[model samples]
Target: MSGTLNQILNGHLSLYGDLPPIPIGAYDSGLNKTQRQFRRANKISLLEHLATEGWDHFRRQESVATGLDRYHPTKLPTINPGVLTSKYLLLVIDGTTHRAQSLAVTGGWEHVVSCSLANMNSLPNLLRDYSAEWISICHASDILANGALHALAGHLQQAKTNTVMTCDDIIVRQLWNDGLGYEHRQYRSSVSAIRLCTRGGIGGLLTLDYSLFKQCSFAPSYTCLEALRLDVLLQITREPIKTTHCHQALVKHQGSKNPSMPEQGWPRERCPFSDKQLDEIDRIKSQHAKQYFGIEGGLKPNPLQAGCHDLSRPTDESSLVSILIPFRDQVELTSTCVKSIQQNAGKSCNYEIILIDNGSADNSTIEWIKKAIKEDNIQCIRLDEEFNYSRLNNRARQLCKGDFLLFLNNDIEFVSESILDVLLDPFAHPKTVAVGSRLNYPDGSIQHQGVVIIPGERRCVLEPGKHLKEQEVIA
Candidate 1:
């Protein structure tokens, strides 16, 4: 590993050099911080070389190519290369204004059919006419990303029964909400299908087993019929279907020309819902949660309009949470954090703040800690050893006396009164391992919304949408 890295660092060798290609195990097995640094530095060049000449070289032989090349150009010459032999069918729904021909169908589809609010009932009938094993549906206005159809076809190979696969979209133009720009909306795996079903449809670019359509009874009046109807159908049925949002950006939304178009209910570009619609949406959301997740009242009362479920154990009412704060000697920051918790803890449940002091030497901080311990009724533990963050939290975890644990930093200050409840709501589900909150800087800029992984020659972590305004939500 060192030798290969040195060659790249010193510009002494190419990927075609005497050494074999860097094995995937080389990343995991042998590498110190310096060795890893060298690999990270040269990742871009290595990836670019692999994509062009190296990939072409391997693909020409076909036998020597890695498993990663299955979706490459050499493998799938066209979207539906073997439509006659393949069991999958790509069905494009030609909307009222945008017909199938206007769409970027370069990837290709098996068939295109006209659809409207009047003829929405004909969907099941149209689906029944197809003899394909798996059926993919998309709107005519929605452009297919390069290799999207082939990717969907590839996905169906191992897809389970009742699994509806939706892909991330690149929003080309959205005139609604006074917004017009390009944005890639990537779905989070942790987000529940129930949360999306009532809010909005996933999108038109989705594929499922042909038979799964039979399980849903469509209402003729539903405007956003393509993907929304299918999603709602899966939710209403007694049997549950897993909603898998593909990580690949497989669809491109051409954007809605008008804001008020009922048929074009794309995720971020939808018009405002009427009071009646909101009521109906809320009722459906509550019903789904009560039926599926066994939440007592459907949605937990949260400041965030998209209410979450309280899936904690039924018998254990009012869960006691232990808030763990680890700090070294920033007395001012620590004081503010404690004050915020005291003021905005809300009425969710009882909680105890366990402040772990990691060898604070400042006289003011030590004095404040002593006063806080006696007056604030908060527990304080002193670790006189070297500052080890993980060790400090682990030590505090041992003394926590709550049903759930919240590891908070001393630099954090709550802006929302319901922050604690919002954080605890997801814990209602017993299988939940952990929940993360969107953090913002003091200046109202995002500190962290979520962590995303960037896969390359070497995998790396990215804090995407890190510095965006607090108002802008990432999908």
Candidate 2:
């Protein structure tokens, strides 16, 4: 079995290149014979280890001193059926005042204002009239889509007493550009985000049995709700808690206005966390990281800097990059944009600038472009029709010879010398289809972090006013 497991691990490493280890019992549906064998071997090994532990524990226990029980086998403990059907109490925390109001309007569930942890204890008693077997605790800023509450209630009612359920949140940006206007920029939570938050027991929204809450109550020592939430999750982690993820986008999270929370501070209307409270929260996070991940140092902060690369390296001419730019006779802007790319993209990045002229009426612009074609490695394609963005790019793409294609507007200017390399690096991963860079307006205000599609909308929009840090976002 050990040999078989080793072979499987080695096979996975060989097949996937230098990637993370394949988890036990995880097999691709389209796995070949060898891969299937590895998964089966791992599962069998785990079951055998569990059986050994159970046997060892039973043997260590002393037998009862009774004449009738002398020859009989030892009896294992039986589970109580009533424990599986315990009722629940949904505890919604008032994070943002508006979130609670939204939930009330959508869910039509009873609400209470609890100033302290002690006040929460009386909630179950207050809700005796309602026959709920599970409690759902969520923030006020979390808005449940229509029928979300009913779906959650149905899942909790049918789920086993020990299971804890949480659904995915669709993060929606409501305010754009400091109240310039409102738009919905909605994106579903990623699997990695959901796993990290929920597995650590600090998930924002939760639906669990009332019995679990009775075993672990909220800590009153922490003044901040975030701290209390973490404490509760830590306590829950002590037991073998079963987590069930309802993979639907049932909740809509009100996007934070700040680049991050607490650092930029909460909204002016919200209560501020003291310096002392912040220190304690930091301590808790540090302790959890050490205990769970075995790291002496704290977790690394986000928007990590790109690694340095040598710009002096010789150009790999074979690895050609085709830059397609569409223009309708803004010759000055087009010239400036092309010059910036040529200077900053480094001589080592073998690239050709393809200019698609969409009916340029200026004789000087046409002559200047013709001169560029002879002097520089600029490829010009003329279209005597009106400017159509999609059509122009597609026609240019058909003529380009590079392995990697970069679609650029005639007005876009390069900011950094390594912009080309940085953008191209992510393509090494086979799953990555396309990548986009952060766009900023002339005055340094953010124009786009990434585009998001609103529900029931044909066009995609960016989050107004909020400038997002560098991270992977679903486009």
Candidate 3:
């Protein structure tokens, strides 16, 4: 069963060259072909017919219901605005907020209401394959633990070109910088000014703020160049949030080669702040306490005074250091890491272990720390939720008392405390935003020297490794 998928994706090995091929289609059987193909060709198709009758499973998760079933194709309606007035297309985003999706373009903001349906069929080549975090974007709904709408919003805003041939030799250049979707983003960032000039003059003007729009909301449910400006009062939540709903919950997934079937007779009216229907939300926001304290009034202690690069704190070259380990759910490795830290240290520096029990699912680690907390300051910050590496580390950083902030992964353990003397000494020189320690596995081999994001991979690669050091050795 898995072999069939391997052949399908491995055929794309020509695309990656020296880099290994990835199994993107392994988990996507329901999206393309299921094992039922040998017996019933139309089995998957029959499922789609029943799905539309009454089903909320595929509401945000878009995929051809019949693709795996093979019995029926999803029924989608095509209505040209030139043909109908009230007959409008509606799209609903999974309630997650992607900053790019919810951008309400104000000045010179002309909205596009149609998608380049033809260009959308182009797949990866449509935008010249600029490779813009596309690996993450293509499977964003899946890569993310939460909603994919927020990620979709960012993709639509980031796309530079999306054009298709039109009647009478016309070239339709879609100009939708601001759009509303499952995600949210500001238009003013990338393009400086993002507003369409005119598209057959049927849409809103380019010089108006669509949020103030009481009449026409954005149009075209999903596209790089189109966004419907539906008037609502509720503002889209910009904080990248997640829902407990697992990816397995989605009946199907949309992919680069494997596209999602559009749900017909569906409407996308609900969004955070799209002239939302909420009457008292404004009052509720005003009444919320955080906005007034840290937000409206500015920092309590001028952050500049506290200083990010303060040299006056400790010049001992080796003092009490604060090590922050932000982690969640990896009991085996985490236990090994904790013990390593407890045991090793080439230097005797006063240091406190800030194990940010970053929403760990394993209560055993939390329990062990609590027993030890009888003496040390193990501030157990229960997130009450899940993991978001950036947010968790930043929160832990604020509580750190050490003169330096050292973020270590829970999977790692310090092999050299003398390395800290070197690590902190460079910070003393004052220009380093971050200084990394030389890390290694028990095999006496280098695990990491520093970290840098290798573009197109979407994950950070260890800068110093076997291959990298070999190049240096050869040089």
Candidate 4:
């Protein structure tokens, strides 16, 4: 296998003139005509297997001189694998019939446990019985990336007693009609954002102290069990437990390439949660909002779509907001923006507009700024220098008095009266950091729904819903 693989690799390397070919070793045993034919036919599959087994090796050998950074692999966090001991346990949860195949991965582990789909209810008791200090749980379908086990074990050993650690997951799905499975897409794990975006939580892999599991309430029914990790995380948040994500470890999850397939845990393509499940999630979120932010309200159903909340909360009368707008010489646009904000600042919260004059050379713009400063709610600051977006915002932010800051462009004119309320609604949850809105062109065409930065060299910044009709609803 090694000799054949080396020859296949060399053949590919020959195409790139600068690189030297890896020397292929002589075969210890002669290959039959049928074996040689099979090897040639399955070359691609063999290469994929090799890549999966040694992702770290290739990642480390990245060549900056050759401009190979464009294909940059995920940076692996440093970890010592010496932590794995008999006291640590690996638990495999397999819902499929491939039990023996799944158990094969845990061959060398000193302490390993497995639970079938039907026996999932007994997991809590099993944890109590096991005398392990740390426990790592993964699905049967998950294929651990090279060095993932060691990385996980190391993280478990070093993490705090109350910490719950999870690794990154790469979702692979078979797309072709061939019996062999090939992945079309790779998904970065969303487990780290569980605190802010609870709905994005995905199950399959986790490592944590055994005591933490004992404290968390396991799912009693089979339906809830599908999203078991999320339930555990929700319970963990109620306490002082710390949730950590290990980017060094990789877990490959085999899912369906067809979007129509109903996935159980995460909301990958569509809403995976039932009405009852969603209600339960909303109830918990409401409780947390009240407890943490002193905000009282349940999530209202989204009128435009099902399985999502409108995230609207009652107006917080006491909270103050600072709206910062930076402008140069466009007085008309600036005037329209300020006027719209003043007229549309709803009863959601108290607000003040801070207009930053960034070297306005026009007399009309300077005069407008002077007159705008006279208002009690509006403040004007003159920075007659080169414009820096960050510098302008920071200077205004330091002087402004508000619990939250809203950065606005000088050209933005609000058409909706409840814009502030809608934008601030997500902030009701303590963990939400920022909120964004959809922007439209003058012709009633979509400018952008949001900016998405993805892992790539070219076209990293993607604008979804661009050029679409403004009336069209985006999922």
Best lDDT goes to which candidate? 4
TM-score of each predicted structure versus truth:
0.62, 0.40, 0.30, 0.60
Q: Tens digit of lDDT per residue, candidate 4, span 1-475?
A: 5764544443222112222121111110122344345556766443442333223322454332111222233333333344456666777775443552344343334566666645668777666667877776666655665445676665565667877776555445343346333222222232332232223334335677777777776545433333455455555655556666665436555553112111112221223356666565555545544554344454565453333344555677888889999989999999999988878878666888888989889999888888998999899888877889989999888778988788999889888786788778766554556667778788766686642222321122222245544231211
Specify the highest-TM-score model's number: 1
- Over 262-294, each residue of candidate 3 has an lDDT whose tens digit, in order, gives 111001121111222122222222222123212
lDDT of 1 by residue, 96-214 (tens): 42465344255555454455544567777766666767666666666666556676667666777767776654444342455423233433231244334323434436676667766
- lDDT for model 4 comes to 0.54
lDDT of 4 at 159: 69
Positional deviation of 350 in candidate 3, in angstroms?
2.4
The lDDT for every candidate, in the order shown, is 0.53, 0.49, 0.31, 0.54
Give each prediction's root-mean-square deviation over alpha carbons.
13.2, 25.4, 20.6, 13.4
lDDT: which is higher, 1 or 4? 4
Worst 10 residues of 4 by lDDT: 20-29
User: Deviation in angstroms for 77 in model 2?
Assistant: 38
- Candidate scoring better on lDDT of 1 and 2: 1
Clashes of each: 3, 11, 41, 0
**Candidate 1 off by > 4 Å:** 1-80, 89-115, 118-128, 143-151, 158-162, 168-204, 226-254, 257-286, 295-317, 361-363, 375-377, 428-430, 450-464, 473-475
